[model samples]
Target: MAPATRYASGVSETAASSPLIRRIAHLDMDAFYASCELLRYPQLKGLPVVIGGGRRKEDDLLGKLQAAYPDGDWTEDSFAEKLDRIPVEFFPRIEGYTGRGVITTATYAARQFGIGSAMGLMKAAKLCPQAILLPVDFERYRHFSRSFKSIITDIAPVMQDRGVDEVYIDFTEVPGGQREGGRVLARLIQKSIFDATGLTCSIGVAPNKLIAKMASEFNKPNGISIVHEADLQSLIWPLACRKINGVGPKADEKLKGFGIYTIGELAAREPHWLVEHFGKSYGAWLHEAAWGRDDRPLETESEPVSMSRETTFDRDLHAVRDRAELGAVFTRLCEQVAADLKRKGYEGRTIGIKIRYDNFQAVTRDQSIDGYTHDAQRIRQVAGQCLKRVDLSRRIRLLGVRVGTLVKAGTAPHADKPYIAAEETPYEQADLFFTDD
Candidate 1:
């Protein structure tokens, strides 16, 4: 048997291993939405930018500024410098927000003030009064998401789409994967993405997905961490139990009641004890996860379950008093969702609608149709019926539409065909994805 060795960060040492030692990597885009916004407004690179809240009249402040100074010696190079001269009040801030909107995501700079995703805009306002607040732009984010994923799959063929901003990659078979315990390949993928999108991501390499997911966040905003099985006690045991991807708040609370505050504490419990406490299957999984043992493979091809579009209004709109505006917004949301499905080459059988009232109460309704479709008109008709099911008497602060139960477009010759397939890029090939025609 080979002596166990471990790798930390990028360096590797001899470590004990079983018959099978695989290399898995997890990559997470840092502040993805905020970073996408920065690509458009590079001037706000280091600023406390928050992407959340409803739309506001002042949301177009940057546009107004650009138009007002169009002929006034405005140039690309001096854009950031000029932004410094503008008054802070010109930008929309979370401070004093009275809407029922929630923060979709906040930049790390804004996170210092304790504001993060799912926080109420009004509550976040009290923490970072001057943070620049921007509305969510799903269409733009989706473009970047596709671009980055395409770049990754070209370099590493086996990848699992975790979400828009994160992915789990199987590095055991990729070139240079076993070299330096996958760090070399990880760096290649990271640099490739940055070159393609001008965005930074964090990568973590380990023996399996369970540990790789946790290690990815060890160093963030353009950093990488590598771990080996032998170092699990030192590298992973000390972390909080909630750090594990599957451990939610409820599980954490339940674990806490049994005096388990960290992964080590959970690991110390016997499997049978954990099973008795957390049920059989989950308890067994908990034991396996606590020991950093996971055999799940990368899912190379997984169709999306749903796609949706939503927006928060600057002010609440009544259903009866502002029926026309509400109806138009609803129709637009449905059309946007339909467009997303079409663009992604997916068709869904379920249509749904979401609404958040001014009083902070939210409701959703969905109906499944006989067949899958991506037609905007059909989506709007079905979504309109969903809207009728919800009580519209209350003033709504946010509106959304969704389509789920997705399947690949039947017009395709193969089920594995992507809407936008990855292509080989030559050294001289220019990246015009984000450039204006």
Candidate 2:
């Protein structure tokens, strides 16, 4: 079984010759979404479970329980309180799934069958048809994400929030940070998170972010690895060139063409040779990254440039036939994006819509307004206008809404002036599909 979560690492310049050494730790949560699901269905432990697709089958599950155990009075409340009572056979399997849905994450047990995140559900079914398929419950996962993150911050004040699953923590000043190269602090933080959320994570402590990021992958679930500045040649350079964080597929392919498949090969090249082939900035970055050199500070506070919400339908939906349903989803996406903006204290002037046709062709359109807003209706109105420009004659497999050109909610130039509201947004044609109706 492979571990789940991925946390970004920090950049440090600590060296053996320097008087000061900075220890940076990169922590990755193990199978975050699947682990959260396991907490709700403990009976599924040690079994192959994959989390993805549509919303949880609450009513469907309750109905199944009522039929299987007529005397149990398995209402929705009972189903929630007694989830463990449900038989394993009652759950849906990936065996016969027919959809464009993708897996968010799968349990370690499922990974043993070659299942992984971002793989289409249908393909996963081919690999492990008997794997239990569960719906993604982001609300529940977010609750656990906050739980574990709060625990980390309580122990170490200087922590970087990477995402819902992983984080980067500065261990230079904390007590016991230098003991065994930050292993003591790492253990404390890992134990604290597990104690609070019943979750496990892997940590890598090193002199800088680049090596730390690579080191975190050395151990699997609930493990730790420590690296020092002196270990760069032995532990880092022999890895593939792609192992360097900055090298993408294209760059790696180019490096391979130049007979530089390993980080050691990249480090051996003259800086001028790399700069001649790659761009000035990127090539220089490649040289530095290959040598495990980074001095970036952890970002404690940050602002987002945009916020969005998107969903892939369980089935392709026709624009006209699924008018009401499409309208509801589009409106929900707008509301969700608006809620995100409000929660983050941001408002945006640019609103956009993205859609994917059954043929897998995707289109995007955006328009900027005079004033910024985080209101759902405003976003829907603009997004609807953007949608009108797109040919929705084909069935849509996915829908998304985005709001960009953001500013702090009360900080836009026209903050005091009232923004004019446009006419209500309509779905299909002007009168054909999406409507208040």
lDDT of 2 by residue, 1-437 (tens): 00000111211111233333578888989999999988878989999999999887678888877887888868766667888777889888999999899999999999999999999999999999999999998999899989998898788877788899988887876887888999999999989988888999999998766777888878978999998877888988889988877788999899999999999899888865886799655765677677676645466665554677888787789888898789889889999999999998999887777676665445667777778899887788778877877787898877888887678988998787646555444333333224322
lDDT values for all models: 0.75, 0.79
Off by over 4 Å in 1: 1-20, 55-59, 66-89, 302-437
Tens-digit lDDT track for model 1 on 1-437?
Answer: 01111111111121223223478899999999999988877767677888986653432665667687776644556654565465555667667888888888788888888988898888888988888888888888999999999999898877899999999987876788888888999999999999989999999999878899999999997999999888789999999999998999999999999889999999899876886799755776788688887645465576554687888776788887776687778777877988898898988777776676664445666676666778776777667666766777778877877777677878533335322212323212322111121
lDDT of 1: 0.75
Given candidate 1, what's the lDDT at residue 90?
A: 62
- Rate residue 73 of model 1 by lDDT: 49
Q: Quote the positional error of residue 366 for candidate 1 in Å.
A: 44
